[model samples]
Target: MVPISRLTVIAATVVLIDQWSKQYIQGHMLPGMSIPVLDGIFHITYVLNPGAAFGILENQRMLFIAIALVMLGLTAYFLKHIPEPFRLMRLGLSLLAGGAIGNVIDRVQTGHVVDFFDFRIWPVFNVADIAIVTGVGCVIYTLVFSTFPTGNQENQR
Candidate 1:
C-alpha cells in the first residue's frame, strides 16, 4: 500500500483505540477516582480535562478547537507532500491527527476530554494524549536524527 494509505490505517487505529479506552474508563470509573494498578509507579486516575496537556489554558474551548483544526489541516496538506524517505515523520503526523480527532470528539460531546492513565509523578492522561506525545516524539526524532544522516547514511562518510 501507499504511504498515505498506511498513515490513514495507523491514524484510524489510534482514534478507535483512544475512543474505546476513554469510553471504557468512563463507564467503569468516576471522575477523580484512582485505581492502583502498579502501586505508586502507575495508576488509572480518571479526570476531565478542560484544557490542553497538563491542564494549561483551562476552559479555552475556542482556542483548543482552533488549534486542532489548524493542526489537522496542516497534517493533511503535508502528508501528501512528504517524500517516501520520511516514513517515520508521516507516521507521526498520522498519530497526531488521530489523537486530535479523538480528543475533539470528546470535547464536542462533553466539553471536556476524558483522561485516565497516571504515572503518579506526571499529570493524568489518556490514549489520545499518548498518541499525540508519541507522534511529536517521532517527528522530533526524524528531524534531529533520521533526516540528518545519522540513521542510514553513515556509508556516505
Candidate 2:
C-alpha cells in the first residue's frame, strides 16, 4: 500500500507552486500584456480565463467550481485505493487533484483563472493547466504501458 500521506505531499507541492506562479503573474503583469521571453516562440501573457479552453462556456462560475470539487474529491479517493506499484498513476492523480485545486482557488477568489504561459499558437494557460495536462498524460501512459498484477499478486508483495 502506498501511504496517502506521501501522495498528499506531491499534490500539495503542485498546489503551492501553481498558486505562487499565478500570484506572481497577477502581481507583475496586467491583463492582455505579453512579454516575449523568446521572440516568436514563448511569452508571459496575463489573462483571466472565465471559462474553459478558448473561453468556452463563459462565466459559468458555480458549475466550474462544482466540477473542480468533484474532480479533486475523486482523485483523492482514487489515490488511496491504488496500489504502490502504480506510482505513475498515483502521481498523475495527485497532480490532477492539485491542478484542479489551484484553478478552483482562483475561480473562488476572482471568478477567473489566472493564466500566464503563452506559446503564441496556443491559448494562454498557467501552472495549474500544465499540471492537469501532464497528469492526464501520465495517467494515460501508465494505463497503456504498465501492467497490473492479477488477483492476489499484489498482496503477495
> Largest TM-score belongs to which candidate?
2
> lDDT of all predictions, in order shown?
0.90, 0.91
lDDT tens string, model 1, 19-111? 999999989999999999999999999999999888999998878888899999999998998787888888899999999999998888888
Q: In candidate 1, list every pair of residues with a backbone clash.
A: none
| lDDT (10s digit) by residue, model 2, range 48-155 | 999988889899999999999988888878888888889999989988988889999999999999998899999999988998998999999999999877889779
Clashing residue pairs for model 2: none
Best by lDDT: 2
Report the Cα lDDT for residue 13, model 1. 96
TM-score of each: 0.90, 0.92
TM-score of 2: 0.92
